[model samples]
Target: MHLISYITSRSQISEKSIQNTIELLNEDCTIPFISRYRKEKTGNLDEIEIGQIVQLKEQFEALEKRKVSVLKILEEQNVLTSDLKQKIDKTDDLTTLEDIYLPYKKKRKTKAETARKNGLEPLAKMIMSQRINDLDYTASKYTSNEVESSEKALEGARFIIAEWINERTDIRNNIRYQLERFATISTKIIKSKKEDEKAQKFKDYFDWSENLSRIPSHRLLAILRAESEDFIRVKIEIDNERALQKMEDRIIRSQNKCAEQIELAVADAYKRLLYPSLSNEALSIAKEKADEAAIGVFTKNLQQLLLGAPLGEKRILAIDPGFRSGCKIVCLNEQGDLLHNETIFPHPPQNRDTDAIKKISSLSDAYKIEAIAIGNGTASRETEQLIKRIHFKNEIEVFVVSEAGASIYSASKIARDEFPDYDVTVRGSVSIGRRLADPLAELVKIDAKSIGVGQYQHDVDQSKLKKSLDATVEHCVNKVGVNINTASASLLSYVSGIGPKLAENIVTYRNENGSFSDRKTIKKVARLGGKAFEQSAGFLRIKNGDNPLDDSAVHPEQYPLVKKIAKDVGKNISDLIGNSSELKQIDLNKYITDTVGLPTLKDIISELEKPGLDPRKKAKAFSFNQNIKSITDLHEGQLLPGIVNNITNFGCFVDVGIKESGLVHVSNLANTFVKDVNEHVALHQQVIVKVLEIDVNRKRIQLSMNYK
Candidate 1:
């Protein structure tokens, strides 16, 4: 029951590392902070390893709490023997603990309980003992007003024995193991719902069977979802004969009359009690594993989407495209503040291309727009085409940004607070433009699940999904290093250790006292104490600050060390900032104190080399086939340029400038065998794909990358 011991047994990480991570987490240190700052304490564990330790710690705490409740229950029932208590105390797993407590748990009215109430316990005990000499007489003696005949008494006794056999820890554990190892999960279409159109999407799973242990996460989740919708029936099957034989071998000791009775009880136990429980338990465990895998995929995709190429502080004209309603357009300044807004109809019901082109050209010249961001939604391709045809005064780069969660952000409370006077359309247009300018800053305002970068996202554990996505956002934000003076409260909140309250307070402090010129001013924010400042100072950047290190990833605590290095080298801190030649002259070993190791020193030197450098790539203009505007325009074997919009365990979905995205299955990702989809494709990655098939009836387009 020791927490560290249990965690060490389950994870390959060292016990000391886990212990240190647990202590840091208990002290309210965040995963990013500990992973970045407390490397010496955690043996240089990354954020993922630290996160695993945190999850395991919570799991062990839950197990211990359950154990305490079980002990109290056993004590009140007068069955808490010293040996039993010791066994329960020694067990660490929840399943094993529950198994030990099963026999002592109170139950409602059942055949076994009724027989026990009628005083058939001794006959049940005789059958369990496998003594045949007086088994019939013992059963007959138990026949009372409730039990009329010896056969009836024996039947009741066998029922009691059946319950006893089911409660045996060895029998339950063995059956659970067999189920986990060899169970086959099969699905069938509900006969009544076979003609249901809604069920056709899951048609691939209508007659599917796969080993439960080997089923991939995406397929398993799909089957389970289909079962949940009642369009399909799912079952977990194992060899019943083998399971029964195993049960008999575990319980039957000899071939006597009592043994024969026990054999009958074992059959009832396997068929009625043990099989169902084990099947459900095994499936539940498998489903949890599948959930974890799906969540991992979701977190990775969210991270990639958030960190996608940034166009960086440009004057952008963003458009939310439409056909029936005119395209909603907004011009954003370099800081993403809305400067102008209007609507233009260049398509459909009223084709006002001339006026639209004139207005767009005038606006681009007036606002000095550098890039054009068009939403990849309805009429997007048409909008891009119309914009291209415009004879603008200046050369403007056009980029089609994914509008997956733009509506969600527009209708959010955050959006309302940021733009109380603006409607959803204006806010949505602003979001599209800001996404092209800086994706991480704008995307953090929306819920990660609504971003449409995941598979089975809504079907997984929501709380777990949120936790993982939040951690990923934090990692990305800290890795990129937020600008303290200009970052929104939403972006600030994800920086290493700053929560919502502190972020709000920091923004308020900035509003009252003007922009932060140095890292020390952050401590002056209301309710932001020493610990918060320590964890957050490194990730918050202050451009053109009094201290040059404020804009870099180097922690403020290391400022003194850098100063010493500067003094030792006979140069000012500013002189050594970007002077790589001078930085190379000083030995790093000399700066490595007991508190700071070579790793921290090396990172400090690297940061000093390129202070405040952005890690994200620059956004570039991508074009779909000019001739292809919708699914109707697609043809088999036609090579087209597309962006990878979503990735899953099975494959990646590519946007080919159509209403329906084309699927490039994992097998089609490369000419050779592709094992991992992420290895070959990423979110927002531009690539050329060939149309393999287009199903107009289902609106599904299959694409391949193997075409020349």
Candidate 2:
């Protein structure tokens, strides 16, 4: 078996689970398909674990291909010997194999290789052995070719052995292990003796440090950025004595006069060739770890964002805010159905005028609009003012909704299909409105990154960012159930079993046949399989249906057991469910076997409480001052307030009612140094800021927590 397959088996997980995960993540299958339809085959492994497995599997395949390529190259050069072949086969690591191949590998001309090719191999070997019994005698065996003297002769021979020892696979591996074991990661800043007052961006990270294990991903990435811009210098090192001792023991196993030669060669090799290569290798390892950690942090932040709050199944009046352009208003019914739409300009020309009041009042009166959702973009506060001018009821709340990428979604093909008759601009406004009522449903229409919840989002690796955001969206969608018949392709794609294409198929099929009354009717959609149906059916609910259990997460497989338990309680499944006392007495283990476990049983019991319930609810809405128009509005020491647009590495980006956001630098977080940006602030958190600087010409704004 291959090493990966062997490792997987050693983990005690079933071979089928491993195989299914690999196949689903292979080039042929997409994440949405694998996550939704292949749960049973993968033993319900989620998208995150499934994605990790795919990456590892690819790495394994690449390593295997590389080994063969290396072996083939070595054979072609006519230097492939039995002992070399043995070492290659025994080698299980890429670094080790590459190290062994270093000497024979084709490269540019080096001093030692040149010397060996010119018939000085014997002289070099004698000095490398370090046996003093024939020191001058061994040196005398070779006459100088390029070098003219005894000192030069010894130097050339020493150079040859130094190169050889440097390239040794075992020796290099030993040094790498020792360095990693005792390494003290050091970071320093080469200050200018005076700070760069002109370049204020990098003043915070001038001096920073943390261990490899303890350093936060964002902090490490920040330091790297600072170094890249020539703002600071960073170095990682280990104890030289500890490393040297380990190197001696590892390389000089024989402990003869040859030991001295080995030590000299090892030290020279490390300082010259080995350090450069291993330094890069070690840093790469560090970055990989940082990437993993960053991805993890992003995952948690996204989860909290995703799980934030859903207004759920509410009738909403959404307004896409604009100034010179009139507000785009759409009234969505209780089921998120767009009941009515209109353009109302209650600002400037007709501020509180009778005509404006009549138009706004008529629309609100017609639909009995329960709530108003104002897009938190340009002119949002003005629009909110318009809504407040003519009051409706005390109970009706006005929310300042984040319309980050609402326009992007509205202009999309998916949005067009949903509102083909309406203009894209109008559709955008409608989306802004609906987002307040249900974030999951509306946000799904836009790419997660466009929602703007991350830091250094555009700078980091794009592919990695996209993959992480997509996975987060998928997880969130699965957690909250989707309506089988009414959910749009954008929203449906997020469901456990449905992907973008399949979601479109389901919607198209529904549009052709009319709305589906039951979950079983979903089978007619193209490309959907039995496995997909089994995993997704329970999560998709029908409000008014013949099967009451359709609204719960309880799988159809457990339908019979639920019925049996209901029978024992002298009631039906529909009634016996939802009551905690009735479910508490049921003998769960009697139904338990290999397939069904306590996890599934408990999940079913929770779903029974509120069938087809949305886990999100809206937080209390508050609209800040309308006067804070732009970054130019602020002055030094001014106590201006803002909402945390995003939390990033260096600091937090705040939306202080401006087109361009302002940054509160990391050092300005408090009197003491701040290690992590997330520790001080979070996404969408409203905060107080002291305007530290404002460069309106360049649109560069800076704020601080400490005011002088």
Candidate 3:
């Protein structure tokens, strides 16, 4: 099928670039490695472009495999012809290939197959020819033991003719095209389940009708979920009269004696086969589009959450706020090791406020805690207030970190291994502190889906979702460059070519042999091969390493070039490491070689300017409105400060330091129309929202940024 040409045409990448990228992928090279290290070979293609190439190549291979299956089936049937083989070989689309093979496909016993078996095939052919004037006489000739009467024979003939019309590619494609343009998706609440409590959330979808093409991904997924739960009956349909007219126009050629029979056959096909098939096809396409959109949102949110501002290495006092069980508090050192673990009753039920205050203050003084991290769950607001009232010895910055996946991480095997002696509460508190310290390292311990930042994430395609979120993690990890000496096995696994086994080996080697002093030491780890080292070296950082460039983004292969640049300036490598002026004097053209291009050389110069620096911003302290503690405290028309916690197509959900997060609909995001909610708000962005409406009964808060 000329897969390279097809992929190039589809992806809009150069043929040469696609070929090279496909070869590299065939050699088991990861996208992160290819995009960052093989830029000169891929024409400077980024990860996204490389990912597209990989997807298209995989798709082409799947289609090719299907084509082989189809060809073998046709050959077994002894129906494969040169022209048919050529057609199948020329087309790479699965749908097109399946359409071409539809007529030849074997089916179980049906009315049409039964009709053909009853010797009514000649009558059907006569009717389809549109030349028979005596159609009744022709049908009468085909009457036999199975077909008792001429009417029965004609009925059988009509069934065969209907099958023919259904199998025609032109008619099916035309109807499919019309369906795509005119289809409407309708949902009806099941009468028995109409009053069901679980059905109330889907009230908007009940008795609703919308153009299939116009429905947003989230809305469609919501409706589909309702349908799957049997709360609603969903249907995709088009205008019957217009759809039938289009089908007849494509199938019927003349107004002759057989025209009426052909018309009947076409109508039967529309009702029995074509319409149902095309409606499902339209729905499937819509579903695929929705899946892609949902996956894209999930990927973006995961990336933002993973690359969220890091609080850096600070001795943190973390709390997983609770009520009856008391707040779980853990004091962590700069390295995120649990130094002290205890319970503090700062909230109701066990309100030992005096003792809790004393405990917190004493721990702060003892650990020399630089910051306090409180999980934004349970009695988080009250916990924050309790901590704020304490007059600690240090000017501790308290952060209300999102505890989205802390529970999942705490109960995980990874957590159990890291702290076997501690309970879930202590482990959770440690996670909260570690997340504040280094978000990427801590968050990787849990599944991305468990983190609550997506829209209909569970309802979307699971495998696709996993692939996309995994890619995002890899991208963020490689982008920020992991510290080999300090990064955990989970964090190291996302670094370019390093997977689970290699990451574990590196960690085990480190535990036995101490920290990796340079990038070159990675190769000495058991089972870490040359290719793995080559792919993973550039993204693994070694701070204060034996070699200075190893800490920078420059590949080990380019250490010589940096050395040459340093020698050219008549200075050692250390003298030119951070000296931007010295770097500026050297011509980038002088360093360009067959293997290295200006894009890479320019990157090396930029890296030297900020060696091993994290691209993420520093985590800063944010304050919620102290007066508004919960939903009960919120009032309409009151402007309050909030942080954007989750985003979707329709709007962004803001946490205004309350139990219930408020929704700022896209229409209320700005005075002008907001086409995309993301353009107006991002995850963790601080903004002021005016309370438009408050539903205390539903525990829902509607907010708006358009208010004065």
TM-score of each: 0.98, 0.77, 0.98
Candidate 3, residues 1-708, lDDT tens digits: the string is: 687888978977998898888889989899988988888899999999999998988899999999999999999999999999999999879889989999999998889999989998888888878888787887788888899998999889989999988888888888888778888999999999998988988989989999999899999999999999999999998888887788778767778868888888888989998888888989999999999998888787788888899999999999999999999999999989889999988678878999999999999999999999999998998999998899977699989999999999999999999999988989999999999999999999999999999999999889999989989999999999998989999999998888999999999999999988888888999999998988899999998889998898889988888888888889989888899887887799977889899888888899998788799999989899999887889888999989999988889899999889999998899989888777788788889999999988778899998987
Overall local distance difference test of candidate 2: 0.71
lDDT of 1 at 426: 95
Span of 10 residues, lowest total lDDT, candidate 1: 131-140
Q: Report the alpha-carbon TM-score of model 2 versus the true structure.
A: 0.77
**Candidate 3 backbone overlaps, count:** 0
Q: Model 2 — which ten-residue stretch has the worst lDDT? A: 193-202
How much does candidate 1 score in TM-score? 0.98
In lDDT terms, which candidate is top? 1
The whole-model lDDT of each prediction reads 0.91, 0.71, 0.90
lDDT, candidate 2, 1-708, per-residue tens? 375574374355566777877766553555545554456667877665666676667667767788789889999999999898888777666787788888888878877777676566777776555555645555555556565665555556767877887776666777677556655455566666226554346556676555655565677677777777676787767666666676667656555545655677667666778777776677667776777666655655666666666666667888887766777788889777778887766666545445655776677778877787888887776767667777664357788788888878888887887899999778987887777767777787787767777654554666787777777887777778777777877878777666778888988898899877766777888888886776567667776766788776666667886787677779877786578787787777776656666656666667776667777655567666666766666778778767777665667777777677888988898787798777788766778888888888668889886564
For candidate 1, list the clashing residue pairs, or say none.
none
C-alpha positional error of residue 434 in candidate 3 after TM-score superposition, expressed in Å: 0.6
Question: For residues 98-212, what per-residue lDDT tens digits would candidate 1 score against the true structure?
Answer: 9899888888888999998988888898788886687777778888899998998989998999999889999898888888889999999999999899998898998999999
